[model samples]
Target: MGRTASVLLRVLGMLWTAPNTGLGLIAGSVGLPFGARVHFDPHTVALVFHRWPWGPGGAMTLGNTILHTGETLDAPCLTYAHRAGHCEEPPVRIGDHERAHVYQYMALGPLFLPLYLVCGGISVRNRFERAADRYAQTGRGWWPW
Candidate 1:
């Protein structure tokens, strides 16, 4: 798992840094229910979403952060493609919003990972995905709607 995480981070970093290539998602154990594909063009970044079994709120928050910061955030499930067309300035995402799978593990590890393995894991992922998705649609990050 450690090696896989390391490799995933490296790959995500590469994808995030590369411009115009679009996001190539690599699903992991802790990935979202239905991932989304993002394409960053010259002016705006277009997101093609695969709606998760859960609702939409987490993805919206996270995506809005990337949009607000003008940063490129890439994870196994969710990713942000840059509109700048340049790799010099890469987006900086931290904590739960940094990567998809990592955040899932972090979310479920404490209380839920021990209980129902599948649902617990998916719940963590779905939450974040919802946030990012909402963020995309509303242009508001995690702020009370």
Candidate 2:
């Protein structure tokens, strides 16, 4: 998409997921000056609350991890980098999945939140999640497997 459309979609995504995104922003702001680090990229923004050594022990203290929020694919994301685990995929991969979620937020608008909550338990097969996974893996194609 063109720059304008992309920007519009991102704004819409933020509005669509306002509650969570707003909270994320607040949390990020509170944490930023307190040893937290925020990283920005073309497709994602990540907020790292702590840079503990990567290992099992570090993961324990970094409980309660939160992922991305907002309508834009490159929205602010909260995560514990140390707990990303054995996937070995770059952290951006998680952001790619979240970008797909931004698209979902754009498509569903306000309805997305309630629907997401209702489907949270079965997210593995949820249409929204499946679409997001597809977008992350392939960048475009979608299938509801």
Candidate 3:
């Protein structure tokens, strides 16, 4: 893609995903007063809140916002798996998986959540999660399908 086209596409993606991103921002901001720190990640093109006081003890990607309970996202972990730990054949970076979800939100816009649930709310059965895992493991295949 040309430079102009790439820029335009990014603008459109941000605009298209604004609603979902808004929801994520709202939910994520609730943690700010409790000591959570937020920063924009250029690589993921998303806002990430670290040391978020809610959720179990991993991370979640909602639109362009990522909420993480840990100090660093590059740490090995599964976004939603149970005690999956860092035992994949190859180490997985949490940031990469969450970045895929950010990209998915850019592509699907408001439809991301509904489609994610329909695909499977949360589990290994969900293709969306699987795709994110694939992206984290191999740096590709973040699409919902």
Candidate 4:
């Protein structure tokens, strides 16, 4: 039960619980191509580690990596922050709050730092989804406000 092994098990467990294809019927609903692959499933909690070649520190924590991805709209992200030396726990998701932060961060940039601080406290997944849908449909630039 080493750290790497534990992380692998966690990832495997998460993937095992997910639909075999990892693609869903709702892909088109989000304006993604019909067969576009999803990076993560909402049904299960998994450890997503950012590709940190630098290794440790530099916002390498799970929360920071997840927040960074949300802030930058970077997909296919990962993090190694949840490691606990052979007994790593599943990473906690910012969920709707993270989603909302992502939307605002993409739309507003650094100017909306104050609001971004509060985004994690809000529950507005529907609004964020709608905003994302609009962004995908028109390819218009987003505003963080």
All candidates: TM-score: 0.20, 0.52, 0.90, 0.22
- A best-first ranking of the candidates according to their lDDT comes to 3, 2, 1, 4
Better of 1 and 2 by TM-score: 2
Better of 2 and 4 by TM-score: 2
**Total backbone collisions, model 1:** 18
Give Cα-based local distance difference scores for all models: 0.32, 0.46, 0.85, 0.32
List candidate 1 segments past 4 Å from native: 1-12, 15-119, 142-145
TM-score ranking, high to low: 3, 2, 4, 1
Clash pairs for candidate 3:
none
> Mind giving the per-residue lDDT tens digits that candidate 3 earns over 1-145?
9999998987798889999889889978999999899999988889999999998788888878999999998898744444345343555788998899899989999989999899887787788888888888788788866
Model 3 residue 54 CA deviation in Å: 0.5
Model 2, position 66, has a per-residue lDDT of 28
Query: How far off is residue 99 in model 4, in Å?
Result: 13
Supply the TM-score for candidate 2: 0.52
lDDT of candidate 1 over 1-145, digit per residue (tens): 6999966864554344333222223321113434432343221222223332234332321221121122233322232323223223233332234233222322333332333344333342344434533344344453211
The digit string of per-residue lDDT tens for model 2 on 1-145 reads 8999988876665566666555555665565565444444444433333432222321110111223222233333223222334233233355566555555655565566677667763335466665655566567843323
Candidate 2, superposed: residue stretches over 4 Å from native: 1-3, 30-35, 45-92, 141-145
Per-residue lDDT over 5-116 for candidate 4, one digit per residue giving the tens place of the 0 to 100 score: 8778655543443331122222212323322222342322322222222323221112111312232233322222223233343332334324433334333433344443
Q: Which 10 consecutive residues of model 4 have the lowest summed lDDT?
A: 58-67
